[model samples]
Target: MVGNNHIRSVKNVRVKGIACAVPAHVAEVTSLTDAFGAENLNKIRSSTGVERRHVVSSECSSDLCVAAAERLISDLNIDRSTIDTLIFVSQTHDFTLPATACILQERLNLPMHAAAFDIALGCSGYTYGLWVAGSLLSGGGSQRALLLVGDTISKIVSPADRSVAALFGDAGSATILEHDPSAPDMPFVMGTDGRGAKNLIVPSGGFRDRHGQSTETSEPGVRGPYDLYMNGAEIFAFTLARVPALVKALHEANTASGKEIDHYVFHQANRFMLEHLVKRMKLPPEKVVLDVKDVGNTSCASIPLALSLHQNKAGSHLSGRFMLAGFGVGYSWAGCIADFDNVWVSSLTVTSNSETEGEM
Candidate 1:
């Protein structure tokens, strides 16, 4: 059932506006030394390169996503009624039954004809979201689509587990996809490995193991069944074993079609692994984008967050032909190359409202 080579090509769809929103609270990595020994803290910081992360106390993923989408719509002056599709990608949804996309449709005030749904995914979600949104708009009926991606991972990771607590952060990002015949053809490659699902997962709370009993112990550094469990070593090994080859395959396909990638953006997982990937692929470090230092790993929001945060930095490639990759979580990964010609890339917007009242 795992498709390791699923390539998709979509036409007449172009990325329009990009925006990101993060919680106001700052959680510095050094502050965690008190909770998790100083030695362990330093080792993590050195390897992860996460100096700070934005975490929310009471805010939910829906709140952050709505904030980001509203800003993107307003900043771009987009006609709300014209949008015909809305897709929300996240693992942390508001409810188990009603899809968060339906809630967003009402909150965003889209037209009655608009179709909305949710995609439950994590780190690899942004690229997948882009592909889905673009494909939906390319169907000739829907002219515009909104992709909202993020996760309030802080709410899932056990506060006692330093592994996840020190690495994960919360962020919501918005990307607009519109129909444009003149736009470049977007080429994509996606894959999945179900065998590694347990390597990074929350084992309980789902119907798979109902009973509601505690599956994890109170080990100081270890996580329990109710907490986020990540086998860092396995993840690193998978990243090294899979990501480079995935990038190479996608690059060859894009280049073969006469496309020149001016920049590259990979999922902001961490520093050590990213550096190793770059070296293994033998790609020039200057072309690769890395912005995880300040925001930590924002899951699906990492790519869009990096695009929004580093737009002003020198050599930042928010335009031209760019290769984008998102990996991890569900043991899934996806890559694509697209042109941002005539697209409006917005600056990063930080919102601190923290209001979870279901309205802005």
Candidate 2:
């Protein structure tokens, strides 16, 4: 007996498998204090729930993507040969010539038919990536897609910037997208604004300007350098406005189910940001799920990381209507809900502070 909400569209998709990877190098706020000077580190830790974050070990975004992908493959015992599509989303790629997906395809050893490519976006990349995979799976364009969100924002960050440098960390998260082929909520909404592009960007390196050598550098409407920059205040203000509106719009617009949603996962930008967003959305604290306090912010990887952790950490207790919201970097954003019926989502330990780090 499927409930009214559970009945869904004859087509709402279920999340099949999710895996997230953090670099082995873990740091405590104190350690950060030691690295960046205790006075400055103190100011950072006091506000954000994050006590520590993972920094990639001598690897670029591709390496981190593969780390998460391996876990997804292992967890599902998925045949590497059958992955029909691979979408690697990241703002940071190893080089200009090869797509990050190509590097991933070779490393993951997938079938050549697997359409591998990179969708370069920032934080919104996860939600946007979901639409790509879901549409392909549901339409039978492909049976499955390895949706990988990877970023090493730390590499390009200016340590002196202080705004995003201390707040973001490097990591990868992957999900195996298979079709419901039956009851998926195929409709999705995505939005972007180039007007806010300067608010968050790595200003250089692209074929558009002939790989950083172009007249654009001397011209107007151009960026400065190939380094990461974020206006934290602007991002926060924008997210606060847009996220709640999108969530409510999706909730009202949903025809798939009538059940009240169970969980809400946001982009995990920071503790305060999420807290404010949750309140503005008027969700009870329990319904809002997050654990990004420790891992800093993993840019495109945030939402999937939340999903991977909450899947297991929340256990059998977390089955029902749930919504996912991702925003940032493009000034782009997206929102969607999933009916996780008859599905078992795995979990992992994702405390902001591990045993030695003390309280959250």
Candidate 3:
């Protein structure tokens, strides 16, 4: 039997604002024709709908996230001391020894009494972060929380590897969650299937394989064991098998509450995959957000990044019932149905590599 697919709701928590940041260095698909060939590059662009991606040089995921957090705090005019909790969610953290969230607390100038930590998750991280932050506020202690999510996935992907090189970009996002007695419940459905872990993973670099040096011969354009390895077929199959059930559960919960989802924002894995999901689920294309053409797949940051970009392009604040889902990496998946009322979404900001150096 499938477990961990039930919907749980958190009450008395509301999102205040969201902001996203990307590196200033843009890498166009056309510039990669030399590595992937003209014909192959054209096919990639057509299938993935990715023309260009913002990349980072000498920048960590924390840098982008910090920039986004600063923008969000400034836009919202939030007092740093009022933020009682900080959660940094990302697979690409600044350092392995010290949790990036701890450093971020000091960098963002959050109060020392605030609870801070990190969640080392990838694609499903943003939803997971929201679930945790909302739950924290609902239980009564933290009045405000900062949910920072993003990934510099380009750092792990080999430039010559066509599988993911042209399909991923670097990005970070910050979301403010506050406790409000009048807010509606946020329902979430989350699950994990470890069986498909190896299908999308880096073979080494962790404690399991410290050096990341293996005797096995590497693929043509692939780097050593530290680089990302993705079995596209398995990932597609996993999504087809698992995500529909997740969405269905959320839909049922929303319907039971006498509401309907106004928008569906799934993780921006790729254009083809998203289009396939839209068709399979019989969802209205107009209500779905597909903004990955310029930014590519941003892993944990995709959902909020898409939301910010969509709202900016529309030149209006996003309000109403929304369904957000994130699946992939660790074979994990999560979906949330929430009611947002004129929430603040900042325009996408561009940060340079030098900004991350030294103190904030």
Candidate 4:
């Protein structure tokens, strides 16, 4: 028997560093007006609060993750060999056969003894990654781990699909977690509802559906099963239904543990959905971090990217207790409370074609 409301805690796991990378290309919302119509595009901009997004054509999500990990390792002066675990979380992996984590471990030059794997999660990934990595670090001996997460969602999403075109972008992030007995305990709550999986998914290209055999390709406005498809209305309703409850539950748990949240970093789904969640939960607007305007939704990278971008502007670490909630795709969601005091936060890095290499 499994529980829907799962709670876990890990002690003495400190976030040592966080770095994010995105494609150099910027696509402004106004630029899409010619295709989506000026009036309709305006409405989208107003609703999603996205003005521009970083996109990549030739690059894969692994490329972005490798760039971010390299920057983090270089900036923090961390010994690559000490990283005992590497977790790569994303939906847009470089290949379907070998796990992207294995490729990343090699590209990043981790020790052969290091553990590596991939997690197929989208928006809820960062918080989940943090939990998984932190838990592994909490044990004795394995002192450090790299949790890399992101997605090149722009490639999978159809350019002609108005529902998700301007809503997503490409980016990757790396978070360094290490053992620190003095660090505060991190608490989290995670839940999933598979009933809503169909509301947002890429119906093909997987073993379950396979590729080049979808029936929806001929349908009006359908971009075949290989392309990303989203039922925005259903996702919106699902968020409205799940996010507030998750927030409230997590908030109560935090309160019970005598932890007062100093900031809320919800997944950068869109401005409208985030604002609604904040309002519904009666959380203070000042405490909520809404930095998605320029980056759009970078899937798993959004939360960490938001933190990185904020620190880049403020020129300081994200101090105090912060509540993070990520909900979307997988119909999966996770919420957590952690303190990032003195954590090394890097400014956003732009991806280049030369950064990607052919072999490890």
- Tens digit of per-residue lDDT, candidate 4, span 67-158: 88888898899998899999999999989879989988889989999999999999999998988888888875568899999899998887
By TM-score, the better pick of 2 and 3 is 3
Q: Residue-wise lDDT of candidate 3 within 1-360, one digit each (tens)?
A: 124467789999999999999998889989889998999999999988999998898889999999999988998899999999999999998887699999999999999999999998999999999999999999778899999999999999998888888999999999999999899999899999999898888878788778877534247556668888888999999999988889988887777688778999999999999999999999999999998888999999999999998898775477989999999999999889989998998878888875632211
Q: Per-residue alpha-carbon lDDT of model 2 for 241-280, expressed as tens digits?
A: 6777777667765644556778888888888888887777
Each model's lDDT comes to 0.84, 0.71, 0.90, 0.85
Q: Flag the better candidate by lDDT, 2 or 4.
A: 4
Q: Which candidate is the best by TM-score?
A: 3
Error of 4 at 46 (Å): 0.5
Consecutive 10-residue window with the lowest summed lDDT within model 2: 351-360
Q: Which parts of model 4 are misplaced by more than 4 Å?
A: 1-4, 216-218, 356-360
* TM-score for all models, in order of appearance: 0.93, 0.84, 0.96, 0.95
lDDT of 3: 0.90
Report the CA-based lDDT of candidate 4 relative to the real structure. Answer: 0.85
